[model samples]
Target: MFSPRACEGDTNPVLIPFLLAAAAAAAAPPAAMRLDYFHTGDAREERFALDAVVREGPWPGPPDRRLDDTGLGRYQFEVRDAKSGEPLYSRGFASIYGEWETTPEARDRARGFQESVRFPEPEALVTVTIKKRDARGVFQPAWSVTVDPAGPAVDRRPPPAIKVWAVMKNGEPADKVDLLLLGDGYTVAEMDKWHRDAKRLADTLFAVSPFREHRARFNVWAADTPSEESGVSRPSDGVYRRTALGTTYDAFGSERY
Candidate 1:
């Protein structure tokens, strides 16, 4: 979730034994906090509602880099101390709902989608806000919710019991910039193939320019779950299979997308 972008590292069935952490601070990085919520609306209007708060793995980001100054993505989220209203952490991210609302279909129908934002856990109650871009591409607050990191409502359960293993482990996840390769659409019978694929991708990444030169700064990890069927749902060809990560080839009605 830290800078590699959410499409890969964030939402995947893990192999099981992974603990990706971050660069050192005076103290250990805070535990990662995930806020799950609903994104619902039509093209004309949108809304957000809290779904859940989760205590995930240890924080795997640069401790000093608490604020995102890059100005990237169509949406942004900010975590602020509830009392003083001082910003604690912030990040810019793009979401499926952000893309869906642009499609012609959204204009005719109202729909709801699930979305989540992750940040370093805070000590006291904090207000998390989601913002969206306006006509001039300026971010405006879309929703805000207050959360207590240690509250009973936070889900502290461990991740799902999928098998997790290191593709290349230089050190513990907390010590290095970790990259995760998630295998989607592979069945239990094809786990071996998934492992191979993950290895190939990780190796290729490290073999390239910037990654190769600074390879020691990174660790590659991987995981996936068994799907009932093989392959993904490719609607363009009428080929459909139920997979753990239900990623389809013909997204947004475009085969190339």
Candidate 2:
């Protein structure tokens, strides 16, 4: 649902986790929030140049009894290869507000509100649509988002995607090869961030025993996907442990969380 350049701004504060006591004074109009794509754990501070987008909007301002009514909201996001103009992941949803309050002076307030949330990564876009519901139960489009105008970095030599196969000795499958997948438990964008980690793991494996001796006869697997589902709960499913990090999920390469 993202077009292009719906709104724009500097690297201002887009999202402050919902605990600001001064939120009333911090509300504002929609602004383009910039974010970077990083490969997980390259270095605590070393981030790869990938494209990500963030937008802020649907904020309540000083009362306009005859005109405007909305509240402050923010989103912290990350996406990988998004700036490459490639389709990877995509979603679209709206944010709604309910539980509201009013001060002695008759100012409207909100307590435990709801908002429609949509994330579309496969579309090479991350979209947030916020709408407000009025007393008569009507929905109105509040704000929209799109980002990363700079595009993705150009690489003459893009690394190969991870692939796994049985090691072959004279074209015959061999055994005992170990595949290790590593990653960060933080965000979906981290999947791209872990690519380097995966390569590093492969190199390390090649430097070690049994693996080193049978370098051509051994293979390593790298599950290059983010662990975003690790913290989520799903019923009627088998419990899964994240081997790369200390998180758990009912996840696999082909299974939906």
Candidate 3:
């Protein structure tokens, strides 16, 4: 139930193919474990509190590439075996909080953002450590928590009941890069249009270079929850509508976000 919104640029058609190729190469990945939490902070300091942990379907990437050697984000999370201390998995990613903390608003008041981190489901107890970049661009421990995969509190409920169809199927999900296109603000009556647009976006992605050459190496899927009303909320224009994705313009005081 705690589905995190795909970040900006995640739905970018051109970026999908490349991201799939790089991130997912596993032949038989494990189920995905999602750790949802509240990231609260001001410009001076921040804190993290556990919200819920859930199983989020089969893991879609290569198992061997669990450690994220790519230092690309403002934050990094690692999952380590509790008994052995050996790292089991790790990934670097950015959150909305990581961006908001830099804004001027953060200087005056603390803000909280719902954030989530996904990794392969571990077989045993593990310690999850979250790290943030320091002023010197070095990663420093921010928070750590222990998680037992089989703990009663871990939510094992199946992912939301929504239709997921492949726009393009290349190979087994574990062997190929998988990209999910989530549609927002589309109405039930516009479901067909959502499908068409999803495919059109995929076509646009494939038309671009390098993706054009390796189209067969990627798989694209689309899922949507129709909104009660069409289009997204734009309070600036005095047009407000609730949508499944809860997406709106003027994020962080910027219209483009």
Candidate 4:
């Protein structure tokens, strides 16, 4: 359960259900696993190679909702039992690589993007499959790899040390939507401002229609590593600065991103 100080004095009776859910989640939840890979391709050819399998922190999603039924995104990945071929988990997601592949630059040359997919740590050996949507919008296998949770090849290094705090806490993470706010270019001196901005953004998000009505069903978290400088680089303006997260302006020729 989150500390009482996390949410301050904005208590409402509506928060009780979410709080109860949080308590249950804390009792027993699976560890999170991440598959990091290089997605290399162009307009005509594509390839995927495994980089590392890492144990992330605790699984924050509901244990019951292991399979994603939503048919969204340009790509999907599935984890299946090695012997039975039974799917244990799946998710649909979009990636920067998926979008970049459609650009004219992809036709001119090959490129690669670092990507990661996260899921609950499985109990046994599993085969992971990556699928992409065809021209007719059907998903076809792009890559597949086998994973052993206890394999010597799996990387178990601890995640980077950074401060994290809850902006809003409703209940156990498994029972609620968890939103992570990642600050891109804030400097060490501006971390306080970043925290305030995260809270303000959460407030703004919950002030909208659907979110406002069901605000109790969500948790907001914020984490950031300070950049040496205070702003992102804008190559169009001939200005550059090293940032902690390496985000830059004019990605894909879009100045505002």
Report the number of the highest-TM-score candidate. 4
Which window of ten consecutive residues has the lowest lDDT sum in model 4?
Answer: 5-14
Candidate 2 off by > 4 Å: 1-186, 229-257
Question: TM-score for every candidate vs. truth?
Answer: 0.81, 0.23, 0.84, 0.86
Candidate 3 yields a Cα-based lDDT of: 0.89
Which pairs clash in the backbone of model 1?
15-163, 15-164, 15-223, 16-163, 16-164, 21-173, 21-174
lDDT of 2 by residue, 1-257 (tens): 44344334642243333335357545433222333342211111111233334332221222222122333322222223435634322223222112112222113322232222213222234333334444555554433345333335322233345443322222222233344454545356655555666667677767888768888655455555455444433333655444334543432222443
Better of 1 and 3 by TM-score: 3
Off by over 4 Å in 4: 1-27
lDDT-better candidate, 1 vs 3:
3
Give the Å error, residue 33, model 4: 0.8
Backbone clashes (count) for model 2: 22
RMSD of each: 12.7, 24.0, 14.1, 9.8
Q: 157-193, model 1: which lDDT tens digit per residue?
A: 9988877789998876656888877788898899999
Tens digits of per-residue lDDT for model 4 on 1-257? 65667557766455778888899977778889999999998989899999999998888888788899999989999999998999999999998988888888988999999999999999889999999999899999999999999999888898889998889998988889889998878998999999999999999989999999999989999997799998888988998988998888888777657
* Top candidate when judged by lDDT against the true structure: 4
- For candidate 1, the TM-score is 0.81
As for TM-score, the candidate ahead, 2 or 4, is 4
